[model samples]
Target: MDFMDFKNKQTTVVVVGAGFAGAAIAFHLTRLGMERVFVLEREEFPGMHASGKNAAMIRQVVPNKLISDLARGGAAFLRNLPLDWPVETKFEQNGSFFLASKKDSEKIQQDGAYAKQCGTLTEWWPIERITEFIPIIEGSPASGGLWCPTDGVIDIHSLMQGYLKSAAMNGAELKFSNAVKNIVVHHGRVCAVQTESEEIPADIVINAAGAWATELGRLAGSLNVPLTPCSRHLFVTKPLDWIKSKWPIVWDITQEIYFRPESGGLLLCPCDEEVQDPNITKNDPLILNMLAEKISHFYPRLSDLPILRSWSGLRTLTPDRQFLVGWDPCVEGFFWLAGLGGHGVTVSYSVGLLAASLIVEGNKSQSTNQFSPSRFR
Candidate 1:
């Protein structure tokens, strides 16, 4: 296949990974009138990894201001999805509470203020208010919490499919179960992508491979942008009368534990992060013990509850915890939309917008400087 064939008609773009990042980028690229977009997913379907396995929470008041800005923008988009959004999704606006002990209370307050300045509605809730909203934290060690009223949970699967569906409706081609084995680069520029069955000629290749991003970059001979896939577990409890569906998500930042109402019960995470291989994640039996310890020390009221089920997912992180969403300086026409860490679901929309702008306008997109792949080099 001649690269000129597709390149002459349309900018042939191949986006690896059909998770939130890839789906959103494809959605926007097509929305912006780009025609030859191909989304290749190794799995039989999209969001088979972290995108589907998350708690589906839309957290906005993160410690990183840059990520917070994207979170705010993404949350706004989720709250008010465009009139033509392809699928129906329910965004549970029960809000979120980022609790902290006295030592970290000031930081939480400051972060909340920054989110507020960025247009997210945030309030500093006292300990009394926190417990009033969720009685389980009554005797907890939390001094106070940052309450972001707009933060909530959404149906992640529906959201992921919505992006793909919209992109497909606009002309992006989605090829599932096609794992890219190698990227064909010539003259320091991406020319084609070799998958399991065939070689696809392309003008641009996007590395949105989530946990496998670093591996994909290596295939393309792009910058070795240190990305690590870390695994974490989420547990769900049996239905309890005390669990309130309207209760906001409560995350103890200092303790690194968070829980929210789910399916007449609660979804909990001990915030365990362990470096792991790209797609191989297993629940360590010891993490459950760790969670038990944290629960006993923190919220005794919710201790020893019957855990119904649990699952693990990967969150790829950069050393600085900021996202990598720009072009590869070492390899031309190879862009990056990876390293979203744990905030992918919360910030995917705005991240896609930024990535599409950079890909289309190149250096003219001044905002790409902060997240440029060259920064790592």
Candidate 2:
């Protein structure tokens, strides 16, 4: 079809998924004056999966340099969003504390330095001094801890809705309960996508399906990107008198456990990871066995607290532990914005901005460009 004829027949783009990655991409696209952006969500509402189910942390102390920059950019945006933002999302400015074993102290220090170069404040605290702020914390596995005051918590549901609402205000079409079943590629380019209800033609397709991203790629005849959806559980404790609500989120890198103040109680995680299919997560009560053991070993103070509630969520990750962004090398018009690992909430804004930039300007900087999906291809 000719340009004008094609314009009359289909949308300029179809973004499959309405989680943070998809919603943010669609939001940025509309902000950049791209009209007719279509967002397809499989759930009854946006962010019902990993986007809303995450721990809602905005931490910058990531494992890689590339994602650290994205976290810096995204954290800044979350800290001070423009007044034009569609909704007022709450961002708690409490800092994050990362502990490391004696052997890993130097390495954690190096990561902190890299984060500082990316623009976040990093402070190395001796194990004895880490108690100055968190008086109740006790663990000798870590010699010291790194403190990033800018790392904070956010109301993820509100943030996700804000992006989508802003996009909708700018005329982006959002269709929930519209799961993509098939992708049509003809003459080496995308032509249409079929849902359970209808087949819609599109000029391009973006795979922001979160844990289901690899499945979407397969449907599009794209290469099997190395992405795994792993399950992790979050546990909350009943109210406690000694637990202050203002305590910063604390993570132990060596032990792979974390806890933070939540609702006059505490939120804890053993950092359990189990690879599984991308579907509704089934609660593995057995994982709590490991959680109990970690608490006894690393954080003995709260081993007696009664469990209030628990839920599981999936985080998709690439084997190299970096995100996979940009266009699929083998697919003519397929783009990827998945495998964000644990930094999804922290680097969300930057992820969307970079994805939209790749779609519109067809270019990116080397730092942000390192996450291209072609790396796996």
Candidate 3:
């Protein structure tokens, strides 16, 4: 197969997911004037898997420096959507509190310092201040907490739709309910992809299949990127009188538990990570016991609340927990945009922008080069 010019507007590019990654990438590619972009989603609707699931929090001051940068950029995009943005979405800038025990206080504070150095405003609030801010957790076990003023929750569904809709408006064809059955690679180069209904020729193929990314890569005979899809459960409580909707997200980094106001009550997670098959998430009752134990030890004040509902979602991860983005070294014109872990909602925009830049310009800067998929090979 002859390699077509990436700059050619006639080049057909197929993205293999309609989740955050694929939607954002298609949006950016179309925005860059790419005319023949096609997005194939297995589900009838977008964000049916990991993109629609999980907590919709925007946590910027994470331990990973590279991911924190992307989170910051993504948060900025959500905070101020473009004037031509096709949809309206809400971003609750209620901020967040990352609680750490005495043993982990130094590391959490150091992470806060690093975030500050990276231009994300952060504050180390003493135990007294934190208790006063949230009276319910007055006797919390955390010695102090890292306060990130910009982190908050977002309307993930709307945000995802905006990206996809904007892309479709710019000549990108989004084909839902179309699963790629075969990625025809002839002589180490991808020529076309056969879907459930028809086959489409492609000059480029992007693997943004979320949890099924590894399976999709196998179909393309691409690199064996160490991607794992881990399932985690989230529980929401029934309405409580004391719960305030404006309260910020509180996370116990040491205990690995987090909670925020939801539906006149609170949403909680135990930060459980269990390896599971792609797109098949089942809630484990044992994890609820673990959540109860963690709540009893870390947040005893609200542990007695009644559980209203629970659901599990997949978070695809690499070995190192950083994002996987770049062209495949094994197959020509095949890109990797998976392995976002659980920060897809917070870092989708920047991740997509970075992937688009690498695909378009084929240049890697010092910062951008860290996420290259070739490193794993």
Model 3 agreement with the true structure over 204-281: per-residue lDDT tens digits: 999999989999999999999989999999999999998889899999888899999988999999999999987565
Candidate 2 Cα errors over 4 Å, as ranges = 1-11, 363-368
- TM-scores vs. true structure, each candidate: 0.96, 0.95, 0.97
Greater TM-score among 2 and 3 belongs to: 3
Residue-level lDDT for 168 in candidate 1: 98
24: Cα error in model 2, Å? 0.8
Model 1 TM: 0.96
Estimate, for each residue in 1-377, the C-alpha lDDT of model 1 and write its tens digit.
11222223278899999999999999989988789999999999999999999999999888888898899899989989999998998899999999999999999899999888877788888889888878898778988988988889999988998999999999999999999999999988899999989999989999999999999999999999999899999999999987889998999999999999999999999999999986565988888898999999998998998999999999999999899988787888888999999999989899999888777765566343698877798
Preferred candidate (TM-score higher): 1 or 2:
1
Instruction: Give the per-residue lDDT digits (tens) of candidate 2, residues 1-377.
Output: 11212223224889999999999999898888788789999999999888988889898887678888888999999988978898889999799889988877788899999988767899999888987779767754678899999888899988998999999999899999999999999876788999999998888799999999999999999979989999999999999999987889899999999999888898889999999787766789987889999888877866777899999999998999888888777777788999988988888899899888877765333235888876776
> Which 10 consecutive positions of candidate 3 have the poorest summed lDDT?
359-368
lDDT, candidate 3, at 48? 93
Cα-based RMSD of candidate 2: 2.8
